[model samples]
Target: MATKKKPSSDQGSSSSALDSSRWEVSCFWERRLQKELMSLMKEPPPGVTVDAEGAGQNLTQWIIQMDGAQGTLYEGEQFQLQFKFSPKYPFDSPEVTFIGPNIPVHPHVYSNGHICLSILTEDWSPALSVQSVCLSIVSMLSSCKEKKRPPDNSFYVKTCNKNPKKTKWWYHDDSV
Candidate 1:
Protein backbone atom coordinates (compact mmCIF):
# COMPACT_ATOMS: atom_id res chain seq x y z
CA MET A 1 0.00 0.00 0.00
CA ALA A 2 1.13 3.52 -0.68
CA THR A 3 1.92 5.68 2.34
CA LYS A 4 -0.31 8.68 3.03
CA LYS A 5 1.64 11.84 3.74
CA LYS A 6 0.51 14.14 6.59
CA PRO A 7 -0.24 17.73 5.65
CA SER A 8 2.47 20.10 6.81
CA SER A 9 1.24 22.12 9.79
CA ASP A 10 3.64 25.02 9.18
CA GLN A 11 2.27 25.74 5.73
CA GLY A 12 -1.37 25.11 6.62
CA SER A 13 -1.30 22.84 3.59
CA SER A 14 -4.88 21.57 3.71
CA SER A 15 -6.46 24.99 4.10
CA SER A 16 -4.18 26.42 1.40
CA ALA A 17 -5.21 23.68 -0.96
CA LEU A 18 -8.89 24.35 -0.31
CA ASP A 19 -8.42 28.09 -0.82
CA SER A 20 -6.74 27.51 -4.15
CA SER A 21 -9.67 25.39 -5.30
CA ARG A 22 -12.14 28.18 -4.55
CA TRP A 23 -13.47 30.25 -7.46
CA GLU A 24 -11.38 33.21 -8.54
CA VAL A 25 -11.68 35.94 -11.13
CA SER A 26 -10.70 35.04 -14.68
CA CYS A 27 -9.15 37.76 -16.81
CA PHE A 28 -10.46 36.19 -20.01
CA TRP A 29 -14.08 36.24 -18.84
CA GLU A 30 -13.73 39.65 -17.24
CA ARG A 31 -12.56 41.11 -20.51
CA ARG A 32 -15.33 39.41 -22.40
CA LEU A 33 -18.02 40.54 -19.95
CA GLN A 34 -16.65 44.09 -20.08
CA LYS A 35 -16.77 44.13 -23.85
CA GLU A 36 -20.32 42.81 -23.77
CA LEU A 37 -21.29 45.47 -21.26
CA MET A 38 -19.92 48.23 -23.44
CA SER A 39 -21.77 46.92 -26.46
CA LEU A 40 -25.00 46.70 -24.49
CA MET A 41 -24.53 50.23 -23.23
CA LYS A 42 -23.95 51.48 -26.73
CA GLU A 43 -26.86 49.76 -28.40
CA PRO A 44 -29.24 47.90 -26.10
CA PRO A 45 -31.58 45.35 -27.61
CA PRO A 46 -35.24 46.15 -28.15
CA GLY A 47 -37.43 45.56 -25.09
CA VAL A 48 -34.36 44.79 -22.95
CA THR A 49 -31.95 46.81 -20.88
CA VAL A 50 -28.77 45.53 -19.20
CA ASP A 51 -26.68 46.87 -16.37
CA ALA A 52 -24.08 45.61 -13.95
CA GLU A 53 -25.88 45.44 -10.63
CA GLY A 54 -22.59 45.29 -8.76
CA ALA A 55 -21.41 48.53 -10.31
CA GLY A 56 -17.87 49.68 -9.40
CA GLN A 57 -17.41 46.37 -7.64
CA ASN A 58 -18.06 42.95 -9.14
CA LEU A 59 -18.49 42.50 -12.87
CA THR A 60 -19.73 38.92 -12.96
CA GLN A 61 -23.35 39.71 -12.18
CA TRP A 62 -25.84 41.66 -14.30
CA ILE A 63 -29.42 42.87 -14.03
CA ILE A 64 -31.69 42.83 -17.05
CA GLN A 65 -35.06 44.48 -17.42
CA MET A 66 -37.41 43.30 -20.13
CA ASP A 67 -40.70 44.60 -21.41
CA GLY A 68 -43.30 42.27 -22.80
CA ALA A 69 -43.86 42.51 -26.54
CA GLN A 70 -46.88 44.49 -27.73
CA GLY A 71 -48.93 41.56 -29.04
CA THR A 72 -48.08 38.99 -26.37
CA LEU A 73 -50.03 37.83 -23.33
CA TYR A 74 -47.51 39.61 -21.13
CA GLU A 75 -47.70 42.83 -23.10
CA GLY A 76 -47.13 46.06 -21.18
CA GLU A 77 -45.75 44.12 -18.21
CA GLN A 78 -42.12 44.33 -17.11
CA PHE A 79 -39.84 41.74 -15.54
CA GLN A 80 -36.35 41.64 -14.14
CA LEU A 81 -33.73 38.96 -14.65
CA GLN A 82 -30.49 38.42 -12.82
CA PHE A 83 -27.50 36.78 -14.47
CA LYS A 84 -24.47 35.57 -12.55
CA PHE A 85 -21.43 34.58 -14.53
CA SER A 86 -18.75 32.16 -13.42
CA PRO A 87 -15.08 32.19 -14.33
CA LYS A 88 -15.83 29.64 -17.02
CA TYR A 89 -18.61 31.70 -18.63
CA PRO A 90 -19.10 31.50 -22.45
CA PHE A 91 -17.89 27.91 -21.96
CA ASP A 92 -20.38 27.59 -19.06
CA SER A 93 -23.84 29.11 -18.91
CA PRO A 94 -24.79 31.86 -16.48
CA GLU A 95 -27.10 31.33 -13.51
CA VAL A 96 -30.22 33.15 -14.69
CA THR A 97 -33.43 33.77 -12.78
CA PHE A 98 -36.22 36.28 -12.44
CA ILE A 99 -35.54 38.40 -9.38
CA GLY A 100 -38.76 40.13 -8.85
CA PRO A 101 -41.56 41.27 -6.76
CA ASN A 102 -43.45 40.39 -9.96
CA ILE A 103 -42.12 37.18 -11.43
CA PRO A 104 -44.03 36.35 -14.61
CA VAL A 105 -46.69 33.69 -14.27
CA HIS A 106 -45.61 31.97 -17.46
CA PRO A 107 -45.59 28.30 -18.39
CA HIS A 108 -41.79 28.16 -18.26
CA VAL A 109 -41.16 30.50 -15.34
CA TYR A 110 -41.24 29.26 -11.77
CA SER A 111 -42.73 31.16 -8.85
CA ASN A 112 -39.40 31.07 -7.13
CA GLY A 113 -37.85 32.80 -10.17
CA HIS A 114 -36.28 29.76 -11.87
CA ILE A 115 -36.68 29.81 -15.64
CA CYS A 116 -36.90 26.71 -17.84
CA LEU A 117 -35.56 28.20 -21.04
CA SER A 118 -33.37 25.80 -23.02
CA ILE A 119 -30.73 28.31 -24.07
CA LEU A 120 -30.01 28.98 -20.45
CA THR A 121 -29.44 25.26 -20.08
CA GLU A 122 -28.76 22.51 -22.64
CA ASP A 123 -28.94 24.73 -25.72
CA TRP A 124 -26.22 27.10 -24.55
CA SER A 125 -23.26 27.68 -26.85
CA PRO A 126 -20.09 29.62 -26.19
CA ALA A 127 -20.87 31.82 -29.19
CA LEU A 128 -23.95 33.08 -27.36
CA SER A 129 -23.56 36.42 -25.59
CA VAL A 130 -25.38 38.36 -22.91
CA GLN A 131 -27.38 40.21 -25.56
CA SER A 132 -28.50 36.97 -27.20
CA VAL A 133 -29.66 35.48 -23.89
CA CYS A 134 -31.70 38.57 -23.12
CA LEU A 135 -33.29 38.49 -26.57
CA SER A 136 -33.99 34.75 -26.23
CA ILE A 137 -35.81 35.36 -22.96
CA VAL A 138 -37.78 38.15 -24.61
CA SER A 139 -38.73 35.80 -27.43
CA MET A 140 -39.74 33.13 -24.95
CA LEU A 141 -42.01 35.55 -23.18
CA SER A 142 -43.30 36.97 -26.43
CA SER A 143 -44.30 33.55 -27.73
CA CYS A 144 -46.52 32.67 -24.77
CA LYS A 145 -50.27 32.73 -25.33
CA GLU A 146 -51.69 32.42 -21.83
CA LYS A 147 -50.21 33.79 -18.63
CA LYS A 148 -49.70 30.74 -16.39
CA ARG A 149 -47.04 28.92 -14.49
CA PRO A 150 -45.43 25.65 -15.49
CA PRO A 151 -47.62 22.58 -14.89
CA ASP A 152 -45.12 21.24 -12.35
CA ASN A 153 -44.26 24.68 -11.01
CA SER A 154 -45.18 24.16 -7.37
CA PHE A 155 -43.52 20.76 -7.09
CA TYR A 156 -40.40 21.86 -8.91
CA VAL A 157 -40.19 25.06 -6.88
CA LYS A 158 -40.35 23.07 -3.67
CA THR A 159 -37.74 20.49 -4.71
CA CYS A 160 -35.55 22.26 -7.22
CA ASN A 161 -31.96 23.41 -6.98
CA LYS A 162 -31.57 27.02 -5.78
CA ASN A 163 -29.18 27.51 -8.67
CA PRO A 164 -31.28 27.10 -11.83
CA LYS A 165 -28.14 26.06 -13.75
CA LYS A 166 -27.90 22.90 -11.68
CA THR A 167 -31.22 21.47 -12.87
CA LYS A 168 -31.18 19.12 -15.85
CA TRP A 169 -34.11 20.57 -17.77
CA TRP A 170 -35.87 18.46 -20.38
CA TYR A 171 -36.71 20.53 -23.45
CA HIS A 172 -39.65 18.51 -24.72
CA ASP A 173 -42.31 21.14 -25.22
CA ASP A 174 -41.53 23.76 -27.84
CA SER A 175 -45.01 25.23 -28.07
CA VAL A 176 -44.51 27.62 -25.20
Candidate 2:
Protein backbone atom coordinates (compact mmCIF):
# COMPACT_ATOMS: atom_id res chain seq x y z
CA MET A 1 0.00 0.00 0.00
CA ALA A 2 1.06 3.60 -0.50
CA THR A 3 2.34 5.66 2.36
CA LYS A 4 -0.12 8.23 3.59
CA LYS A 5 0.41 11.72 4.87
CA LYS A 6 -1.77 14.59 5.88
CA PRO A 7 -1.90 17.51 3.45
CA SER A 8 1.74 18.51 3.03
CA SER A 9 4.13 20.57 1.02
CA ASP A 10 5.09 17.82 -1.41
CA GLN A 11 5.27 17.06 -5.11
CA GLY A 12 2.30 14.66 -5.26
CA SER A 13 -1.03 14.06 -3.65
CA SER A 14 -3.35 11.13 -4.24
CA SER A 15 -6.93 10.25 -3.25
CA SER A 16 -7.46 7.65 -0.57
CA ALA A 17 -10.06 6.48 1.93
CA LEU A 18 -9.57 9.68 3.88
CA ASP A 19 -10.42 12.62 1.71
CA SER A 20 -8.61 15.01 4.02
CA SER A 21 -5.21 13.43 3.37
CA ARG A 22 -3.34 12.23 0.32
CA TRP A 23 -0.93 9.44 -0.53
CA GLU A 24 2.12 9.31 -2.72
CA VAL A 25 3.05 6.68 -5.26
CA SER A 26 6.72 6.24 -4.59
CA CYS A 27 9.39 6.16 -7.33
CA PHE A 28 9.70 2.42 -6.93
CA TRP A 29 6.05 1.91 -7.83
CA GLU A 30 6.24 4.36 -10.72
CA ARG A 31 9.13 2.42 -12.25
CA ARG A 32 7.26 -0.81 -11.67
CA LEU A 33 4.14 0.49 -13.41
CA GLN A 34 6.27 1.68 -16.29
CA LYS A 35 7.90 -1.71 -16.69
CA GLU A 36 4.56 -3.45 -16.67
CA LEU A 37 3.24 -1.02 -19.28
CA MET A 38 6.18 -1.79 -21.54
CA SER A 39 5.77 -5.52 -21.20
CA LEU A 40 2.04 -5.26 -22.00
CA MET A 41 2.70 -3.23 -25.14
CA LYS A 42 5.29 -5.72 -26.34
CA GLU A 43 3.28 -8.89 -25.94
CA PRO A 44 -0.33 -8.47 -24.92
CA PRO A 45 -2.59 -11.49 -24.89
CA PRO A 46 -5.30 -12.09 -27.48
CA GLY A 47 -8.18 -9.65 -27.83
CA VAL A 48 -6.54 -7.09 -25.59
CA THR A 49 -4.76 -3.79 -26.20
CA VAL A 50 -3.84 -0.75 -24.16
CA ASP A 51 -3.59 2.95 -24.91
CA ALA A 52 0.15 3.34 -24.53
CA GLU A 53 0.17 7.07 -25.09
CA GLY A 54 -2.40 7.60 -22.36
CA ALA A 55 -0.66 5.24 -19.96
CA GLY A 56 2.76 6.86 -20.58
CA GLN A 57 1.59 10.38 -19.92
CA ASN A 58 -0.48 9.44 -16.90
CA LEU A 59 0.58 6.35 -15.04
CA THR A 60 -2.40 6.63 -12.73
CA GLN A 61 -5.04 6.33 -15.44
CA TRP A 62 -5.40 4.01 -18.42
CA ILE A 63 -7.91 3.19 -21.14
CA ILE A 64 -7.92 -0.35 -22.43
CA GLN A 65 -9.81 -1.97 -25.29
CA MET A 66 -10.80 -5.58 -25.22
CA ASP A 67 -12.54 -7.48 -27.97
CA GLY A 68 -14.70 -10.36 -26.93
CA ALA A 69 -12.79 -13.62 -27.27
CA GLN A 70 -13.57 -15.90 -30.17
CA GLY A 71 -15.98 -18.80 -29.75
CA THR A 72 -17.55 -17.04 -26.80
CA LEU A 73 -20.97 -15.59 -26.13
CA TYR A 74 -19.76 -12.07 -26.79
CA GLU A 75 -17.63 -12.81 -29.82
CA GLY A 76 -17.05 -9.89 -32.22
CA GLU A 77 -18.27 -7.41 -29.64
CA GLN A 78 -16.01 -4.61 -28.49
CA PHE A 79 -15.79 -3.11 -25.04
CA GLN A 80 -13.78 -0.31 -23.50
CA LEU A 81 -12.29 -0.52 -20.04
CA GLN A 82 -11.12 2.26 -17.78
CA PHE A 83 -8.59 1.73 -14.98
CA LYS A 84 -7.91 4.35 -12.32
CA PHE A 85 -5.03 3.71 -9.98
CA SER A 86 -4.79 5.16 -6.53
CA PRO A 87 -1.43 5.76 -4.85
CA LYS A 88 -1.83 2.26 -3.46
CA TYR A 89 -1.84 0.45 -6.80
CA PRO A 90 -0.87 -3.20 -6.83
CA PHE A 91 -1.67 -3.09 -3.14
CA ASP A 92 -5.05 -1.41 -3.59
CA SER A 93 -6.80 -2.68 -6.69
CA PRO A 94 -7.42 -0.27 -9.53
CA GLU A 95 -10.88 1.25 -9.96
CA VAL A 96 -11.81 -0.67 -13.08
CA THR A 97 -15.04 -0.26 -15.05
CA PHE A 98 -16.41 -0.96 -18.46
CA ILE A 99 -16.56 2.42 -20.08
CA GLY A 100 -17.52 3.76 -23.53
CA PRO A 101 -20.42 2.67 -25.68
CA ASN A 102 -20.53 -1.08 -25.60
CA ILE A 103 -20.49 -2.54 -22.14
CA PRO A 104 -21.06 -6.29 -22.20
CA VAL A 105 -24.35 -7.49 -20.74
CA HIS A 106 -23.26 -10.33 -18.55
CA PRO A 107 -25.17 -11.24 -15.41
CA HIS A 108 -22.40 -9.84 -13.23
CA VAL A 109 -22.34 -6.56 -15.10
CA TYR A 110 -24.62 -3.67 -14.27
CA SER A 111 -25.92 -1.27 -16.89
CA ASN A 112 -23.88 1.42 -15.21
CA GLY A 113 -20.74 -0.48 -16.27
CA HIS A 114 -19.71 -1.81 -12.88
CA ILE A 115 -18.47 -5.38 -13.12
CA CYS A 116 -18.74 -7.90 -10.31
CA LEU A 117 -15.44 -9.62 -10.71
CA SER A 118 -13.61 -10.79 -7.61
CA ILE A 119 -10.11 -10.15 -8.91
CA LEU A 120 -10.98 -6.51 -9.32
CA THR A 121 -11.65 -6.40 -5.60
CA GLU A 122 -11.48 -8.98 -2.83
CA ASP A 123 -9.27 -11.41 -4.73
CA TRP A 124 -6.84 -8.85 -6.10
CA SER A 125 -3.13 -9.37 -5.53
CA PRO A 126 0.05 -7.44 -6.20
CA ALA A 127 1.03 -10.15 -8.65
CA LEU A 128 -1.89 -9.24 -10.91
CA SER A 129 -1.19 -6.88 -13.78
CA VAL A 130 -3.36 -4.83 -16.14
CA GLN A 131 -2.99 -7.62 -18.67
CA SER A 132 -4.19 -10.21 -16.18
CA VAL A 133 -7.21 -8.09 -15.34
CA CYS A 134 -8.22 -7.90 -18.98
CA LEU A 135 -7.84 -11.65 -19.31
CA SER A 136 -10.08 -12.25 -16.34
CA ILE A 137 -12.73 -9.95 -17.76
CA VAL A 138 -12.67 -11.72 -21.06
CA SER A 139 -12.89 -15.06 -19.31
CA MET A 140 -15.90 -13.88 -17.33
CA LEU A 141 -17.72 -12.79 -20.45
CA SER A 142 -16.73 -15.89 -22.37
CA SER A 143 -18.12 -18.19 -19.74
CA CYS A 144 -21.57 -16.66 -19.83
CA LYS A 145 -24.43 -18.25 -21.79
CA GLU A 146 -26.95 -15.51 -21.08
CA LYS A 147 -26.71 -11.87 -21.96
CA LYS A 148 -28.33 -10.03 -19.08
CA ARG A 149 -27.64 -7.60 -16.31
CA PRO A 150 -27.14 -8.43 -12.65
CA PRO A 151 -30.31 -9.09 -10.70
CA ASP A 152 -29.78 -6.00 -8.60
CA ASN A 153 -28.77 -3.84 -11.53
CA SER A 154 -31.37 -1.10 -11.13
CA PHE A 155 -30.91 -0.54 -7.42
CA TYR A 156 -27.14 -0.87 -7.36
CA VAL A 157 -26.51 1.27 -10.41
CA LYS A 158 -28.51 4.09 -8.92
CA THR A 159 -26.78 3.94 -5.54
CA CYS A 160 -23.21 2.82 -6.15
CA ASN A 161 -20.20 5.04 -5.83
CA LYS A 162 -18.94 6.37 -9.13
CA ASN A 163 -15.81 4.36 -8.45
CA PRO A 164 -16.63 0.66 -8.46
CA LYS A 165 -13.78 0.04 -6.08
CA LYS A 166 -15.67 1.93 -3.40
CA THR A 167 -18.53 -0.52 -3.32
CA LYS A 168 -18.74 -3.12 -0.59
CA TRP A 169 -19.08 -5.92 -3.11
CA TRP A 170 -20.50 -9.26 -2.17
CA TYR A 171 -19.33 -12.04 -4.46
CA HIS A 172 -21.69 -14.97 -4.03
CA ASP A 173 -20.90 -17.12 -7.03
CA ASP A 174 -17.82 -17.86 -9.03
CA SER A 175 -19.61 -20.33 -11.27
CA VAL A 176 -21.27 -17.59 -13.28
Q: What digit string (tens of lDDT, one per residue) describes model 2 on residues 25-57? A: 335466457767877888998998999999888
Q: What residue pairs clash in candidate 1, if any at all? A: none
lDDT of each: 0.78, 0.82
User: lDDT by residue for model 1 over 1-176, one digit each (tens)?
Assistant: 12343334332223344345332322556556766776787798988887544521567788888888888888889999898999888789998999978899888899999999888988889899989988888888888878898999889999998999889898888875
Segments of candidate 1 deviating more than 4 angstroms: 1-26, 52-56
By lDDT, who's the top model here?
2
Alpha-carbon deviation at 38 in model 1, angstroms: 0.5
Q: What TM-score, computed on C-alpha atoms, does each candidate reach?
A: 0.81, 0.84
Q: How far is candidate 2 from the true structure (C-alpha RMSD, Å)?
A: 7.3
Candidate that would win on TM-score: 2
Which residue pairs in model 2 clash with each other?
none
